[model samples]
Target chain A: MSTIFQDLVDTLRKSTLHFADTKKLMNTLNIIVTIKQVPDTAEVRIDPKTNSLMREGVPSIINPEDRNALEAALALREAHDGTVTALSMGPPQARDALEEALCMGADLAVLLSDRAFAGADTLITAFTLSRAIMKIAKYDLILCGRQAIDGDTAQVGPQIAGFLDLPQVTYAEGLELKKGGSLIVQRGLEDSNQWVQVKLPALITVTGRINHPRYPNLYNVADSCDDAKIKIWTAKDLQLPQAMLGLGASPTTVKKIFEPDRKMKGEMIPGDERQMAEALITKLKEMHVI
Target chain B: MIQLVPEKCIGCKLCVKACLFGGIAVDGKVPRLTDSCTGCGACVDVCRVEAIIASGEKTGPVCDFAAYKGIWVFAEQHAGKLHSVTLELLGKARELADARSAEVTAVLLGSGIAALDGELFRHGADRVLLTDAPFLANYRTAPYERIVARLICEHKPEVILIGATTTGRDLAPRLANRLRTGLTADCTGLEIGPEGGLLQTRPAFGGNIMATIATPNHRPQMATVRPGVMQARLFENKKGETVRIAVSEEPGDGLVQILKTLAREKSSVSLEKAEVIVSGGRGMGEPKNFKLLENLAGLLSGEVGASRAAVDLGWMPHDHQVGQTGKTVKPRIYIACGISGAVQHLAGMQSSDIIIAINRDPAAPIFQAATFGMVGDALKIIPELISQLNANT
Candidate 1:
């Protein structure tokens, strides 16, 4: 990991000359990036024993797109001489993700964890996160991953922006701070790319296409593990009301959770490779999909 | 918190079977809630003895249920053309409306796009709430959210359906929060519950599981369904009344300004639009081996796609990746070559009209999602396929 980080740093050092000298700017951005720790869903499996998701050994990692969001925040800070706060809401185990963020050059890391925060849906989660952001109090921009793989809702960022009543730009593939306190963001839409300019104090959710997240530096990784560098906050820290904190506050309840019904299974084609190829072609032709 | 009423406990262990998370276990005579319990209420419904309950679960209507009426679809339009998802949503809204005996309304927002209302009407909208303004011509978060939130505040539609497209995903959440209502995202299925609530069902955990959700206590229940998940039926000559919502010509707040919109380059195949997709994965061996997939895609007039493994290995571009971290594609025919289908990869393409898997291992999970499977070396079989195609065409 350190070798990759070193190589990327060397390449980035060479490319840094091409950018404008942002140090001349009158004011710099204070950015907050929201991240989540999720089970690497790629390797997640259903356990035959309990018929439940086999998460016993599934590795937890900073959500893929959240890394991109952190990279965006880090890049901005590097260019403009600002601070990047990596904030997260999850169980205590989520500190690993925040540590990774700090190792990747986040100036500060805050983990919001408490038993009262369990079982919150997207709305309540966003509400709780918004309250935490309020406690952080000074932020020119808020960045988040488009969605977490566990949920796949892509709702939290915009919902947070909603609770804060801030303008938001989602699916951001690229962003740059401009003169006059405006942010120029390039959004990757379904069929097109849109360029929008929003003022500071807005929220942006970045996609993985935005940038390659840098690996944590070897030295930074060691330092990031120091407990003093990480702050743990609970529901009381954010002054959240009991009625607004947990499962009870969440309006949407999960009525059921089950393995996806496999309505149709593929028929295995028989015979040798040549015959199999020929058979597939015949079926495609018959379906008029050739 | 999940609770068990000891007096009512029968300990049938049905709740244990119902819980997908293994949150409940029958200990001796009574079932006990474990720390893993998410309070999802799956156990509560399965308990025949009514012993389990998620205390503080909203059982009564939190808001006046009689005040809210009508089913509304946000008729998303871009450059004066209605997005097909809007029509699909209208079809869904029509079904939902019929279930509850409510009127279907399409909320159209654009400048000089009243002509699109006719299409909404033909697609099962009983009414069109037209909000035409210069500022509303293109989608910007602030103005659109403001207007839509205002309309919802005034009209109080019992349910609002929006396509989970780029704009809708961005708009709906903020609007839902502003209205202090629950909004389910990327719902693949929606139905009126016995209590007249919208039961929204969507895939979760990288599509390993399906979760049904409901906002039991919120008014104007909201949900966003992804495009292509719902079918749009045309009801030709269906008539509807248009109610004009006058908006100020001036831009509100001026927080965001649209600079430009660029259509994606035509050189790259649009994976979502492609009818056929030939995908490669880790088993393809090397980056150079992708040429086989490229050739196959060219012959089939399809696009080439890749699994996350191939992309992570630097064998393919990120845009070509199909998985939870990549694009979700539902082509008519998806050919998976040398791919061991992980749940994440399956989440993206399991909805394809037909899936053909080619792998050397018959036991590979990809076979489960395939419409037809062949256990063989993809590198050898692909060449055979190419040669055979040459002979035929």
Candidate 2:
């Protein structure tokens, strides 16, 4: 066969496969939204002695941006008539955030909790998540928050994409499904916004600006926690190797943690607003800033 | 652990060019693995067709990490413009490089931006590796990661730094994954550690704690520094050599398309540039009341800032937020109005020269750090202060 004939055949073959894939994608979306439960950052505090967050009394919530991820998955499901699965990795208590996702109308909730998964860094976390994702097959889309408020590392989603070897669109602020299972997305960057087109079976890390998550209903919250709707998976359940899912698998280790000293003893100017404002402006003048 | 989904390949030899081990061979449009494959996943990224699986990867001992020399910075450029964090990294990198008698190299990839290489040297880089190609105009993860990873494999650098901006957050992880190396993100401090490894210190657990991380066994220790965290060395008149690499212009995988791009940002009064920042919180009542802070800022020639609460309340935009999740500001004076000084809010602005709190509650945490504290209604105090400042100025 001529080289031109072979090239044409390859292009035609790829296009037809994509066209049929799009037909299936348009009708339904099997979406997995990954979320992390974190200590409410507002009340977060660090122990000066140990140099770590004092999570003892601090309450945990779904990491702020993860709500946007859940909202994105729910929106896609609402538009395409499909199942939305909320997946979270944390201690057993992290199940609360997954239940919240269920309350918000997710079809399935999963909590990957086990003693073995403790102290796992982003790389190990991505490894464990990818194993579960692959085990639960037929997922067409994966959504994640831009970053976790606790770890503050945005690496997991992209690392998961790397593990699964899938194309990824990060900072996905807007999305529109196109014909043939392709998607038009608006990505918010540091300086400007960019619109890009990507195909299905893709991963996206969304920012909080993407959408305001809907509140969970009172009745739905009760139903979501029902045993039939939520499943708890351990390392063995996912058949994940013991060495690959925990602190032993982590590549980076913290040598030390310390509280940063940001305090400065300052002279308090006592007074009402009028007197304080006068004194502040006077001090600015004394410092030659006014 | 490295495998290839042969069906995903498009007969592209880009991966063949990427692999330094000479282990990936293409025949009949499919890649076959060889015993020599070092499992260095560099080819994983370049194969935008997503054919290479570098996962389940457990690193077997790397070549002596000490063999890598020189400190390199990824000089980020967008639309022919450079990010300031690159200059900051160059400044710090120069110090580390000199301490170890190593050279400082800047790795820059963008179309038609090689001409800006001289600026990199003025800031501290000894050499700039320039890769220019039309396909490099818009920042795509695969192409950019491939070029950098391929270069790192060829010319091993002891340390690599990237800006922790949006592009950095997206690209750095992919590069680290491809190299199967350790990456520390949003590092505020970088120092040469014991045994010559790079010690990266960053605020972890929501800025409540600082964690010092070290990559003891990884080559080309990689870290991303957030913009404004490090001071950029002042530019000097100096000449630097540039080594240009010829990049292939082939459209990568054609997996993602750039449908449209918004233009560059307009120049606005940024909180980072403000010397005096007068910020309001939810106690400001409504968005319209923010005008009081704006008026005071105008009289003081400062910027009006907001707490995450105000931004969340829709009283202000996220850009105006001054907190952990928002822009960190080190203004000369930060006046708080009705903000209770939540830890998240204080994490971004506690470095100010002087803090003044104006909450009605005397026991608000904002008063703890404030040089001056006032007990009053923010609504009444703000308007009166705005009138007083306007009258005085």
Candidate 3:
């Protein structure tokens, strides 16, 4: 055969194989991603007089690490045929986060919002989310961000695993679905990396290093704004005991919030850039810091 | 439920300002609770006229606080070495235990690691609870959870402290849920309250603010403290008794399997161990600019650290990040180059003995924490400083 003809035949054969692989039912997975809408921490400030958080102008964004988790779930679904459900427990405004997840290609979005869930700590939040997860019971995997920026507790995902009686892996940066019903995950530990394998129906919490989240599709952005694709659930919708739903059910309570003392004021070097550098070096030597 | 007593309402609107959640509106002559009301009691505490009444909706079986006693530290170990945080926690436990006239018990788990009990005692443990088993050698969530939960049920510890390392973060929450108790994470301070409750103080909102939390109605009040946040002391010549608990055979292979572990390189010390750290952030502009930071760090015989923004921007690895989500460091010196010093970053390195901040923005928050502040471009300043130091040598 001619060289051009031979190349054409090979390309055609590769496309045929790709089509066959997609048609075959293998390694399908159902994934649920748990996300949170957190106020942009950089913009968070405290009201000096009231000594409370000044959240007036702070914009709420999808928790950064949770975006990585959603990206991991979307990538998994692309490789294997499955559905990705994005779930969150917060105020009604949390629907904005789920809608963004929908724009990112999540098959379904759920918002568990109610006044009763307002003062929930990590444990109550986990209980509320786990109740929703049980309601959407057809899943082989659950993914969550390692922690939310606002609370920084990092307890909800593991607590959800506890509530659902599922095995869990935390701080996952890499994931691979095996041919069988197991997943190999690389967990980012402090000062080390650990690879572990767990069967299906397990939960994994992902760190920000896992993958960069893709921008939401513009078309999906418009469609995602439609209220039909997003489902809202209150404390009553989950049918969980009110005792395990909110402030009263929480094991931990916040006694007070205050600003840490900032008493130290440094001496600012007064000079041009080059002059400041020279002065800094001299001071360092004087203090023996260098 | 948050209710306003209209008869006594002065309508000072102090409650409105105190409601962090924007739950109260003073639109009416008296404040009315909105759907946003979380009943956090912030408004109730501020209402000097006693106009607001906050009543929490009670639920669940009440805990019998009297039944629980003694303080427990989950003494974590890797390979054959005990984590330094374990000692720090034991020290804090010793302080709390001393206040209550209670004993401090260190729960040590690992195969053939009973030898660690001596160090635990020297660090302030009154007793050591050892569980040595082949299955317990590695920290798989299920087995460790089962063993630790079983021990807690049997011993009835009043307070439990775990290091907020990866392993502790994984294990503490599961145990909390299984026990149906409350747990606080990454606490900076732990103290016994006037009402005999464990007051756990931790940073929230990305370390922009601090909140004091309490497990008021739960037994075995648990909190995870990050390393270097607490001081570790030695009791020199102190001794404690060790009770070895037998482990039953696990029913089957665990749901998860450990494939491999890549231990950190010994030559590259962790940021927490570095005496000096020259750090960079978003203001470094690009990935290549981090080289200047590396050069400065090399000259100072120190390591290079990155703010979360630099790490997230792929300018540096996650291991180099210093912030609320990263390793807490208290180095002898911390040089923040072109870093704006987010509160999260300050939470990690502000405790350093000396801080030097170099940023173009005079308003950068890092300056507030710096012992020395230079308002200039880091790119221009670092090279000049490097040449100057080189000439000095």
Candidate 4:
């Protein structure tokens, strides 16, 4: 068992003993949270000629969905005693997001950063994260946001589960503790919902509806900045091959990025109520809309 | 000039299944590309076996015609009811077809949906291609793709348009993959080009920028439009005709089954479809504070919504979230509270009829887009607005 998992188990056992009713308390609870620092999506701009993102001056922050995932983990910690560890892979600045996680209530933070870990697509990203989790050794549950706001691929969680050879319950809305070391979770499917039970050490990706995250207090924020003990590991430190860490490991590459030209000026029809309706109808007819 | 390595082929046959041009064939255990391949790389993404490679070279049959021939719209229907977006697309298609002196054809597919044929023609389809099959009843991936691809192949329409719904998203990619054609998804605007091609425009980079794409080299340029973005043409008195096509007898795996569907109790209003929306943000403070937004929405006969910030804070459900990650809405009136108007949130509701911003921060970005701006606390402004509205009522 990994140290973090053992610590989580210990915390759960202690809580169970304190409660004095194993039947009432949930068993085998541990949370592994996946977080990422993406360029603030609101601040991103595109160069018209290149059609590529103008990333400069855009501040990076924890992805909103990832923050929700962290909050879900924290809520689980509060409801049923367990340890929450934050994990991320990016440049050195990514440590800030993990630190924010610690300040928010994460017991530990892990940074997977190195030059070789750059330019990773979702597949390579999930692979590296799964490998890092394997190295961490102990975790009863894994949690991530459904998708990153920037890419909007919604592929990482499922890909990571595929890499780790684990059954995944994605788009999780709610979680409940079951008696036999299993979790009953409500998953959101398109047009419907499903409830599934999975054993310990399962992976789940949470949507924004899962839980409301609490804001960090002044003391916790101060402690997060001052009492920093973030464990930083490179591909070498994790014993991962260099080829499997970065662009070399990634299967997909963006060949070109260009702005699509807008041929017609999207005109907004204007006038008073009757005139407006008439103009809209006339415009539609003129354009052969009818 | 996409390439497929025989050695790398795991024989998942996604490329074979996706090829609309019929340019690829499964030879025992590998996919073999032919001279008709257009190098669109639609198959590259779906090939889990990673056998298909995009060489990025243009080495297929170049379209010989300088002038486009026909205008097509990928007509979308659900539960025997055609989406208004499809009619809206027909409106746009009618414009393009008139400009190019081409014919407008709407492609309809589903089981026993012939009753909708007359309605489709009345909404501007010069001709309708109907395909009925039991397999296409519930919007399954494989059957819809097969029917749409077959129609496109047979009819050879110059341009094809589909609404960017869940069904359209799934079908377009697969059809594009099969046809070796270019497809642009989530287009907010579209125009017919001088060269008789399509100018497909959509927001990219997390809705930070708008991109207009064109498929100059491929026939039947494809694009998907969002619902409510385009204006649907009013019904006309002119008569039109429908042609029914035989459904193919190809067997589908049907690996995924719908065991049961439980309609979630419609709790709050659906923000995307609501005419009026009142959205709250982190500025509202605690989760309890969101009730003011709910009250305001109720008074306005609107739906309560939240920015990604409020949703992230767990103050509201994800369905009510208005941002890039959530639902895109175009309501008649959208009142934002305490929301700083993050670009993601703006992208979803920027097209609203009237925008009202209530924020303590004078420099909030929402002010730029708002028709009415009040520099005050949302907690204070909300109750006041509610009382004023009550007085009027």
Residue B284 displacement (Å), model 1: 2.2
CA error at residue B299 for candidate 1, angstroms: 3.4
Q: B1-393, model 4: which lDDT tens digit per residue?
A: 677888988776766665556668778787888876656454553455547765534332245544446888877887798988899888888888888888889988888798887787777788888888777776655466667778777677788888766456546644554454556666677787666567876666676656666766566677777666777785677567788888765554242223334656665567767878989999999999888888877876789889988887778977788876667788878888899876667777878876777788866767767755666777876776666556645
Q: How would you encode candidate 3's per-residue C-alpha lDDT over B1-71 as one tens digit per residue?
A: 66688878887786675454467888655778898665555465445555776555532323566879999
Give the count of colliding residue pairs in each prediction.
Answer: 0, 1, 0, 6
Instruction: Candidate 4: give the clashing pairs.
Output: A51-A259, A260-B212, B18-B178, B19-B178, B20-B178, B20-B179
Stronger candidate by DockQ (2 vs 3): 3
Model 3 preserves the real interface contacts to a fraction of 0.86
C-alpha TM-score for every candidate = 0.83, 0.85, 0.83, 0.62
| Candidate 1 runs further than 4 Å off | A1-28, A47-52, A221-223, A282-290, B1-62, B249-252, B318-332, B351-353
Candidate 3, residues A24-55: lDDT per residue as tens digits?
Answer: 32346889999899988877865646656788
Lowest-lDDT window of 10 residues in candidate 1 chain B? Answer: B53-62
Report residue B239 deviation for candidate 3 (angstroms): 0.8
Interface RMSD of each: 7.2, 3.8, 7.3, 9.7
Superposed by TM-score, candidate 2 places the C-alpha of residue B3 at a distance from the truth, in angstroms, of 12
Candidate 4 error regions (>4 Å): A1-147, A151-191, A194-290, B1-19, B22-69, B193-196, B216-220, B272-275, B391-393
lDDT per residue for candidate 2 within B1-393, as digits (tens), equals 677999988887767765656778998688988877876655654455657766675453255666799999999988898888889889999988988899999999988998889889899988999998888888887688778878987898888899988888888887777666678998878898767788899877766677899877667788988777777786578778899998784455467778888865753759998998999998888899888888888877899899988998889988898877788788988999989776667777877887888887765667767776777887877777777767875
The per-residue C-alpha lDDT of model 2 at residue A265 equals: 52
Q: Give each prediction's DockQ, rounded to 2 decimals.
A: 0.34, 0.34, 0.35, 0.10
Which lDDT tens digits does candidate 1 get at residues A1-290? Answer: 43354354345434533322222322378999999999888778776446478887687888999999999998998888778889999998787788778778887889999999999988889978887887788899999999998888899999888766678999999999998889999999877999999988999999988999998865565445656668999878865546656888777889998776544466999989899999989988997877
Interface RMSD of 1: 7.2
